[model samples]
Target: MLDSLKVTVLAEDSVPYESPLLGQHGVSFWLEATAANERRRILVDVGQNPDALLYNIGKLNIPLAQTDAVVLTHCHYDHTQGLAQILRAIGKRDVPVIAHPSLFRPNFITAPFFRHVGVMQGDEPADVHAAGGCLFPVVGPMQLMPGLTTTGEVPRVSDFEEVGIALSTIDANGRVVPDTMPDDIAIEARVKGCGTVIVTGCSHAGIVNILKHSVRPGERVAGIIGGLHLVEASEERIAKTVAAMSEFSPSLVAAGHCTGFRAQAAIYAAFGDRFATMGSGTVFSFTA
Candidate 1:
C-alpha cells in the first residue's frame, strides 16, 4: 500500500503564484509515491514546452534525474511534446516510458478549427530510444509500482459522455475518423489510509468513465486531480459530470488545464470546500 502520495504541478495553463514559473496550454505533474520504505518518482505528461517544464522544475527544486518512469496519458501535443527534453533532463537512457502503442497515430482537433494536435511530427519513438529510454506500450491496465496502476483504455459506459467532434485521427486507409482517445489513461493509487487518489491528464476518455474503470469494488476515492476536458462542454454535460462526481464524494478535486472556467465553477459549486484550485507550481500532499 502507498503510505503517501505527493503531486506537484510542474507545468500547466496557468500559474497560481507570481513566481518565475512558466505556464502554457498544457499540463505536467511530478508524482512521488512512498510505500514500505521504498520511494518511487514518476512523471505523468510532459507538457507542450520543454522550457516551461525545465524552468518550473528548477524553480520548484525538483531533481529531474531521479524520475523512475515517465507515463503519457495520450498522444496530444499539449501532453507529450516535451518528452524528449524530459528524458534528456533525466540524463538516463534506460528509464521506462509507459504509454499506449496507438499514441503515435495522427490525431487532431477539427471543430472550431483544423489543427494538427498529435505528438510532434518526425521520429518521436526514435528520439525516445536515442535518449536511452525504453518504451512500454500497454493495451490494458498495468501496475507500475506496488500500489499504483494505470487505467489503460477506459470503458465508456456513461451515456452523457462521448468523444467530442473536435477530435479525430487518420485511419490506416488515410480516412479521417473520430479519435476515441483510447490512449487516454489515468493513474490510480491506493493510499494506505486515505482510500484511492486518481490523477489524470486531459481525461479525454471521460472522467466518469475513468473513475468507473479505475476505482475497484468497495474502494472509496479520496481525491481526484488533473484536467476534466470540459472546456467546451454544454451546461447539461457539466451538470451531469458534477452529479456523477458527487457519487464518489472525493475529498479533494483539483481541476486545471483543459477544465475551463465554466466547468470549474460548476464543479466548485457542487464540490464546495472539497474543490481546490490547481495550476503550475501547485503542490498536493496526501498522507495515510
Candidate 2:
C-alpha cells in the first residue's frame, strides 16, 4: 500500500555542507509517505530548540501546517523540548502526538554530570492540548499509517547493547533507579518492494534489540537511519553491534546525532559503500 517515502533531517548536531540549515544538539526528521495518491507528513521529533527546527523547516521549504502528526521516540528533553513551539507553528490544526505512556516520567543522566534530561519542565499535557495536539499514548506495537508502525517498547535481548550507565529515573517511592528506557521506540516503514526501513532516535533501548522486536521473520531491512546511541560504547560492544547489523545486510545505514564518530567509523568500515553520510539537512528518498 505504501509506494514511496522521503526523510529529511530537520535538526541534528552538525551540518556538513554549505547550507543555511541550522544545527542543534538534538534530532528531528520530516517524514513524508505516499500511498494511493495520498501523502502524509509526519514529524518524528521536535529537537531541543524551536528556533533551530523552525529555521531548518523554512530552509528546507517544509510546510509545518501540513504535518499530519508528531511522534516522540522518548521523553528526553532534546527530543521533546520543541513540541510546544512546533504546535504553535502548526496553527489551529490539532495534530496527533504519538508516544509511549511513560514518556513524561522524570529522567536524568547521572554519569558525566547529574543533570535533568527528561521533557521540558511545566504542564506538558496541558501545553499539548492548548497547542491543538491530541496525545496518543501507546504501550505496544501500533500502526500509524498503511505501512508505517511504531516499534513500541523495545526489549533488551542483546547482551552487548547496554542502556548506558548515565540514564536514571525517579521511581514511585521517589528513589532514583536505572532507567531501562522501556519507552524507547522507533518508526518502521514497510516499503512495497524495498522491505522495511527503520527510523530511530537515540536508540536507548538498543538498535539491534529494537530491530529484533520490530521486524518480522524473513522481512529484510532495506535501510536504517538516525541515532545509534553508540557514542559512549566500548570497542567490544561496538564490534558486537556491527557484527549483528552485518547480518541484516541493509542497503543503507545513515547514522548521526548521538551515534558518535567512533561508532560511525566502525559502522562505515563494516558497511563500506552502504553507509551513507548523515547530518542536518540530509535527505533520503526510497521508492518501490
Candidate 3:
C-alpha cells in the first residue's frame, strides 16, 4: 500500500474564486503516490484544451516532465484531446499511457447532428507514440504499482444509472449501436491509513458502478474525486445515485466537471461536511 497520496487538480471546469489558475470544460489530475522510499507520479487526463491545462500546470508548479504515467478514463474528447501534446510536454520516453483497448474507436452523437466526440485528431495513438508515450490499451484492472490500479472496464450493475447521453458508435456490420462507454474507469489507490481513494474521469460507466467495482472487501472509501458526467441525468436517477453514495458513507466526495449543479447540491445535502467542490488548483493530501 502507498504510505501517502496526494491529488492535485491540474485542470477542471472551474477555479476557486479569484484564483489565478485557468479553467475549462474538462478534467485532469496529477497524482503523487508514495510507498516506503519510492514515489510515483501519474497524470490522469489532459482535458480538451491543452493551452488551459498547461497554464494550470505551470501555475500550480506541477512537475509535468517527471510524470511516470497517464491514465485516460475513456475516449471522450474532453478527456483525451490534448493527450499527445501533454505526453510531449512530459518529455519522457516510453511513459505508460493506459486506457481501455477500445479507446480509439469512433464514438459520437447523432441527435445533435452527427458529431464525433471521441479522441481528436492531434491526440491519436500515432501521435502519442510519436511523442514517446507507450500506449497500454487494457481490458482488466491495470496494476500501476504495489498500491495503485485502474478499475478498467467497470460493470454496469446499477439499474438506475445509465450513459445519460445519446452517444453511439458504428459496428463492423455497419450498425449504429449505442456507445455504452466500456472504456470508462477509475483510479483505485490503497493509501495506508486512508483506506481506498478512487479518482475518476467522467464516470461514463456510471458513478455507482465505478464505486461498486472499486471498493474491495473490508475497505472503506476515503475519497471519491473527479467528474461524474451526470449533467443530463434524470432527477430520479440522480436521487438514486445520491442514495447509493450515501450508503457507502465515504469520507469525502469532491466532484466537478459534468456533475451538474443539481446533483452537486443533492450530494452536498446528503454528505454535508464530507462534500467538496473540486476545481482547478485544488489539492488534497493524505498521509498514512
Q: Pick the candidate with the highest lDDT.
A: 3
Runs of candidate 1 with Cα error greater than 4 angstroms are 111-113
lDDT of 2 by residue, 56-99 (tens): 89888899899988999998888889698789898855689999
| Model 3 segments more than 4 A misplaced | none
TM-score of each: 0.97, 0.97, 0.98
Clashing pairs in 2: none
| Pairs that clash in candidate 3 | none
TM-score (C-alpha, index-matched) for candidate 1: 0.97
- Candidates sorted on lDDT, descending: 3, 1, 2
Maximum-TM-score candidate = 3
Q: For residues 179-266, what per-residue lDDT tens digits would candidate 1 score against the true structure?
A: 8988899999989889899999998888999889888778889889999999888899999999999998898999989888999999
To one decimal, what is the Cα RMSD in angstroms of model 1 from the true structure? 1.3
Q: What lDDT score goes with residue 245 in model 1?
A: 90
All candidates: CA RMSD (Å): 1.3, 1.3, 0.8
